[model samples]
Target: MTNLKLTRFAPTPSGFLHLGNVYSFIVTYHLSKKHQAKILLRIDDLDRERVKNRYIEDIFDTLNFLELPYDLGPKNLKDFKSSFSQSERMGQYAKALEILRQSKLLFACDCSRKKVEKMHPKGYYTGFCRNRKLPFDQNETSWRLKADMHQDISFKDLNEGHIVGKLPGILTDFIVRKKDGLPAYQLTSVVDDLYFGVDLVVRGKDLFGSTLAQVFLSEHLGPNAFAQNTFYHHYLLQDPNNQKLSKSAGATSIQFMRKSGKKKEDIYMMIGEWLGVKERIKSLEEFGRYV
Candidate 1:
């Protein structure tokens, strides 16, 4: 059988889905449908302190409300907490870390953020702990990937065309695992994408830096781990002040919009206008035709 295209909509349930979130989802959904790719709803509930049940519920509710469908993921809260949660995938992360460790590409560091900043005024870790060989204690130190110095990495973004940059400059020695024994976002996201065979990733443009880092990490893991994947970093929905819409700012959340009796058609029309479509979009199905 031919390998099918796989795309994922990963949302961290730290806050309610805002307009920016909705726009990204619309883009992802439209693009996935365009390619007839399988879609997965991956909830990135890594931030223990901020991730709440209400936010998780908001994700499902908003997706259902907008009729943005997915092919895989937890059907409900029970499945999310049991099988789909990132917290339950520690062993997989550990195995990947072991690979990095066996290759001598992993190191432990206990440097505070302020200290690291003070050490490198230019704001990148220049191997201060690369040779220090810090002890491996989950409670005491963070595991960082030893990035290649002065190496160039680039990828073709659907929107931006060819995007290129040098590593350790764009992505210094980033954390793969936190001090609390939990897998970091960079590590878990890459592992999940690789394991699930995701060939397409659509996220906000602000994560371009993250995309580069992920590409680098994937290269270290093996050939074509993410090298063959297609990425689309779409434009972010910003506020009047030019700030990206954020849940913390309480900026036009979907939950609030729903409470205010705004129907799905209202959002579709808004997105249609944004996309420069002359005609009003009656529903997501109609909008999909335009995209």
Candidate 2:
């Protein structure tokens, strides 16, 4: 069996790909190359409301424009519809959810976001409904994992070194299954990473809390979970307000840049400048030379 580290650029195709997306992709791509790893381009199209066909096509367009190569993914839209879509993997998610349920690690939650925010002024859920033993009805309530709020979860990040934080302090009682019968990001991502054997996950530091949640899930899942995985949370690209750039915020996107007549080298140069690399780059492939 091959021992090559498996890394993935999992993008949620909810909107057009933006500069932040490019930056994170560059970081992930560079790290994968540095470690001699295989890359998988996984599309996270879980949120049906925001996921768009145009966004999916735009992902391929942007990656092609940057000349990024991956070892796995759909070759075309047809393949994507038939195989790579996350909605097609519901059975896998259901099985994982069943495992969690059987372990008695999950509890039904009926509180709405507004209600939770109102109950906890600071926004940290105090497990108000965890012990209510609410019935699990897809139409009525979401499911939350039984988090050890008092315990701290720590992990070794490749870039940040050792980091520690309390799960309750950093994140609220996270949803494993939405009341609308959808799998939560935390559950799907953990399941997907485990299934795909992804060893290195590179993304923005904003997701550090998310990493903690996933690590928490991995530990609870079993000994085999997280055995092959590690993470690298890189610097985030923020806007003028210092807020992280988001697709929903109408951040400058690759499609907009291309429409503005920006060349591929220009995009590389922007990344180089942000990363403080002295020499400019003409292509995404040349970015490694400067590093």
**Candidate that would win on lDDT:** 1
Instruction: Summarize candidate 1's per-residue lDDT along 1-291 as a digit string, tens digits.
Output: 123489999999999998778878777888887777889999988888899999999999999998878899887888899888887877878888888888999999988777788887776776688889877774569899988657777886765667787664535888898887788899899998987789888988788778888888888775555876788888787665666688986647888888989898887776666566789886767856654
- What's the TM for model 2? 0.91
lDDT of 1: 0.81
Best by TM-score: 2
Whole-model lDDT values for every prediction: 0.81, 0.81
lDDT of 2 by residue, 218-246 (tens): 77775655734667887887654566777
What would the TM-scores of all predictions be? 0.89, 0.91
Clashing residue pairs, backbone N/CA/C < 3 A, model 2: none
Q: In angstroms, what RMSD does candidate 2 have relative to the true structure?
A: 2.5
